[model samples]
Target: MIKAVFFDFYYTLCVWGQSLEPRLRKITERYGFEVDPERYVKARENLYAEASGSDPTTHSLLGTMQEIIGSYCEFIKGLGVQEHVEQIAWELLQSEHSLFAASAATLYDDAIPTLEHLRDAGFKLAIVSNWDTPLDPLTERLGIAHYFDIIVASHDERVKSAKPDPHIFNYTLAKVGVSAEAVVHVGDTYEADIVGARNAGIRSIKIDREG
Candidate 1:
């Protein structure tokens, strides 16, 4: 019998669209500067492309934000928006709370009820997320933090490796004090969740939100 269930955070337990706009606005406000949201979007997209690759460097949201903001400042100068760049940086620095707000991402209607049912049925709960930001506050915001017996965020040095690496899955199972055969994982990423769980000798369920 499966005694425990592990879950992935983004796309599995949550969903969002255009998540960066709020922070972009906050930055603009702080700097007393303005730019077409579309331009900022382009800059952000460029930054994402620059930071992304197969080098296997574990990713962090906070670090990415810093890089993206810096890139945007330089790009804005090219676009003649240099005066407003510091405002953007200042806003980003002050808007950690607002950025955290994006973490909600509208949990699936079935997610909570399913979690409650499983918990009541004696299933141990844990979260194994590949996020650069601290997840404890976001879990508290979701009100389901208590449901989890353990929460592991990639930001924690203990999880030096990111998804697609079985280290995290193995570590989580170890923490829950369960054997791989007695645990199951649920996540949205085929490579990360499915492959990682399989590598760790655990069964996995992939949630396809589009389906």
Candidate 2:
């Protein structure tokens, strides 16, 4: 029996890519740069690729965003004030809704019911995610912070690496005083969440929203 249920934030519990449109528009409008949204997305992919191969010695959301924005800034031939461009990029980079309810996530209709069932069944709840910001602020915004006993993010410093790395999961289990043998993880990414958790000795549930 599982004593605790750990969840991944993006695509597992919440809709991943939910912020893309807003971020694209925000950056385009603020910079007066006509960039293809898809290309902008590719730039983000490049940033992730750059970070993924290296150890988590110094990975951060701002660092990734800076890379992408710097590329864009160069491509645009310095149309607007560098500071203004950076400000827009900064706001877009730090996009997690700090005060919104978890309901904003468009959670699968079954998610809440499942969580409620698990809670009623005496399972401790927690979330371990690959994110730049602290989980507490986002959880507080989502109003579901109360449901979790531990919420760990890459920015937490307790764990520097994101999923696909076991650091955050290991930290969470330690924090909850539970053993990997007694806990399970639920997430959307096969490589990051499924394989990562498995390698860490935690059973994992994959949420394939695309299917």
Candidate 3:
């Protein structure tokens, strides 16, 4: 019997509210480069998946500031920016243009209802995500923080590793005081959540928020 539930942050429960596309285009055009918004989003989605797969990483969850910026540089270069990629990427790394911009994402319409139902059903709830940034501010603002018994991120000092690394899930299970057989993790990604949970001896359900 499942006595607990774990959720992924992005897409599963929340989505980004704004796009940096317009700003990216403005910046790119200023530098004599061009970018297509759809392609940009698509490319980034691919990059993030690659990062999760065994670049064995998460959203700078374990990266230093310099390392994260280097990833952005690679993103610009991948966009076919032959020159000034570093400069352009650096400028775009500004908080306003950053992927980690504060309260940049909002919860899904059903997020609260789903969480409340689970809690009412007597399940322990948690959020275990590969996010690099601290989620307190966003969770608080979204008004969903209180619903969770605990929230763990790859960036957290206590986490042994990020998703796809079973240790992260093991750590969470230990903290939640729940057994692997009694917990079910729900997340948007397969490799990060499903694979990790399976490896850790926990069951998981992959969600397709995009679909």
Candidate achieving the largest TM-score = 3
lDDT of 3 by residue, 45-84 (tens): 6655654654223334345556667777877877878898
- The C-alpha TM-scores of every prediction are 0.65, 0.65, 0.74
lDDT of candidate 1 over 1-211, digit per residue (tens): 8899999886677655433456556556666766575676566545433422111235456565665456546655533465756665545444432354464356677889989999999999999876766778877887889999999876687777666678878888889999999999998766677877898899999887644
Go through the candidates in order and give the C-alpha RMSD of each one to the true structure.
6.6, 6.1, 4.1
For 1-211, candidate 2 gives per-residue lDDT tens digits of 6799999876566652455455556566766756565565555445434433333337556575455456544433333334555565445544533222234444556667777888889999999876655667656765577778888877666577777788778889989989999999998666677877987899999876644
Q: Once model 3 is optimally superposed onto the true structure by TM-score, how far is the C-alpha of residue 39 displaced, in angstroms? A: 7.1
Q: Which scores greater on lDDT, model 1 or model 3?
A: 3
Error of 3 at 84 (Å): 5.1
Strongest candidate by lDDT: 3
Candidate scoring better on TM-score of 2 and 3 = 3
- The deviation in Å at residue 51 for candidate 2 is 7.7
